[model samples]
Target chain A: MIEILDTAPLSSVQDLGRAPYLRYGVSYSGVMDRLALRAGNAMLGNAEGLACIEIQAFPCRIRFRAARDFALTGADCAATLDGVPLPPWWAKPAREGAELTIGAPRRGSRAYLAVAGGIDVPSVLGSRSTQFRGSFGGHEGRWLKAGDVLPVGAAADAAVQAPGFGAEPPQTAFPADWAPPDLQPSTTAVRVLPAGEYGLFMEESQQRFWDTAWKITGQSNRAGFRLAGQPLEFAQRIEMRSHGIVPGVVQVPPSGEPIIQLSDAHTAGGYPKIGTVIEADLWRLAQAPLGSRLRFIPVTYRDALDALRQGDAWVAALRRLAEQYRSLCNSGRTP
Target chain B: MTAEEIAQIATWLRAAGLDTLELTSPQTRLRLKLGAVAPVKELAVQPAAAVPSSLDARATGLFLPIHPWCETPLVQPGQRMEAGEVAAFLRIGPLLQPVTAPSDGIVGRCLATPGKLVGFGTKLFEFSPEGKAP
Candidate 1:
């Protein structure tokens, strides 16, 4: 068991998120960084998609009610266990009463904390993810508050060692090649594929979509990131039907400013989509700080599929390494 | 360093067959070289009588005193550390193997260079027991 000692808004229990319910108009709200949560669970030998705590606000403190193995992944939050410094993307065993303090991240925006058995919040709608909009899942369907005691599921086995270990961060494992051939150096770039209405935009707007450095504005949230830059105008206005939209769709409202729908995006929208950020690179977009400029690099569908396969490969390799480490540690050998 | 402390270090250097003794802290850096008598100014005011021992690396890899994400060093001079606490990490390709303290002690000087490749059993730091000033 773990108790929240101090917390800020937007910190909640989240898994990989619910699925097949978008037709009912439910937003698929979940953890912003899926790979980070998956890697954390792999380290603790937990099954894939187990719920973990997603911390967006800084300076949160948690007290371990019992000794348990846990891992911290994603943003380097400069976490400390009872004043002992913990490296980023590290796993360690916390003694009973150990206090874990998470500070402001120096790099990424979100951090994932996965315990041995995962956070035991009730699974709602076939998922443990918190749908804040629906108010129906995860720790009373709201952000965690001070003095909240969260229950942990029973661990699968006691094979994990106390000395602890770490896994390679995905950024380092698979370096992002952000060299946009036609554009100047941008803050961070994610590959994008042309969407249904890409050809309908004006020639200049289409060129500018790939050329301009779009700045994320203050209005950005989990639902979507509102970008401010050169307004992307269509060749001619036409009435369009509302279509199903998922996370990563870069929809251009009539105002010409584009909004990249994210985890909490509405199930359907009528806005024209010029492009969609590939699923493999959503984590990059999620970690982009507000006010930072982003450039989208065009990629083919084949490239996007290859990128997805590579991402899955990395996660599988890390899980295998973790299993090897656990067995070696249990046998009194250090890997 | 006091005269008595200098003499004690000199005796240890001779007994251990070492040529030099150097120590560093947040506020001071001191070096004692054999066959060269340099005027000793105020350096680290540590417990002179305490004998310092070496903390060796348990694996072969690149050494990092501070984490890649944070600017601060993990273990610094004058900081007390518990036994089994991580003092540094050895980065072997993508894996990070921890270098932990063998016993409770106060840190003295980091003997290994940050980002330099080191082999197993390499002396990484100089430390003494909790009450000892090394």
Candidate 2:
């Protein structure tokens, strides 16, 4: 177990985000930085949905009661293990009594820390995700605290650790079909699906949405993302009916600005949903550092489904590659 | 279209995974959404759009459009304040305290019940202007 000596606001337990529970009044609680979580877990050779630490605005200080191996990813928080600088997106081992300190983010908003066996929190409603609004997840559904002695768990197969930072991240057209270009964090474009309430707005407002860049205001959280952009409006004929919504659903309240729902959004809402973002690009939305400028390019539903399917296939390929790597490591074929 | 046809369309748009739907009938216009908020997911969506939504008041507090959270209400068709003023306020005990209007607006609808939770961002009053809704 680990101890959280001190922590500030906006930190919580995040897995692959709780799901199929929104209908029960529970928000989809999970890591704000989804890709980072996956990368960390992949380093640990754990299951895909393993729980990980989600760091927000400020970094956290921790003293590992029983340090083993861990990895950091997402948000590029300049991390230092026991005062020695550690690389991001790579795994390393630490002995007991070592202090691991992660500083403020150098790039993204949230950073993910994943260990081998995952955080040992009592799962609620079948998830270890901390639903902050409801206050229940890891460490009593709050941030970890000092003197919190974590229990010991089995180390990952150890042999499965990637040879170096140059290994591939498993199945994808990203490897063979294209130029076999490496999958690095390269582009910054965000995509959206022109689904739902897009038609209600006047043509001018729709044009404005795609024609300009929107700045993300600091007034954002798991609940919703308040954006700063052109105050678009309609001919004054919208009714507020409470309804079910999902993450990435852009809602236009009376303020004329749009509030994009995120992982910790409310299950029901009263605003008009302009559109939903594609799942693949939601990672980019999640990874956006503060004050980052972003734009929306709406795609058709078929395109949205294609993106979803592509994401699913990619994750499946990663899982299979992880299993193969484990087998290879165990068989002494490569170590 | 008739109200029956409009309501039926609401059912279909919802089936199509649509969150916002508008139905303009010869007698009435309806805007509805299926809200998925928590702690109080009760029909935030107008259960019946053809009929007027009730602004049931829990207490005798003066009606204010301010949600206590700083977001101003967007004036739209068939729109009514059920609750919440999302107005940004001074750093108070609450995150964004809902600012209430000093002078009460017209109490177009209210059902008195005191000592309730006084839900955050609930529309406690309905203001009526002398001029008709545009």
Considering only chain A, what is the TM-score of each predicted structure? 0.96, 0.85
List model 2 lDDT by residue over B1-134, tens digit each: 34444444444345345676543333444565667422423233434433222233221122333222123432222343332321112111111112222222222433322223332124443444323342
- For model 2 the interface RMSD, in Å, equals 24.7
Worst 10 residues of 2 chain A by lDDT: A163-172
**lDDT measured at residue A253 in model 2 versus the true structure, 0 to 100:** 85
**Span of 10 residues, lowest total lDDT, candidate 1 chain A:** A178-187
Q: Which parts of model 2 are misplaced by more than 4 Å?
A: A150-188, A319-335, B1-134
lDDT (10s digit) by residue, model 2, range A1-335: 77666567556667887788889888998877676677667656777677877878566876677756676666656677778655445455666777778888765577777777777677787778888788887568776655555543465564333222211221112222221133223324466766567788888998887666677789987677798888878656789779998888888888879888999899889887777777766877876765776677767778767766775655454444444434434453211
* Candidate 1 off by > 4 Å: A158-163, A181-186, A333-335, B1-65, B71-81, B92-94, B105-134
For each candidate, report its DockQ versus the true two-chain complex.
Answer: 0.15, 0.01
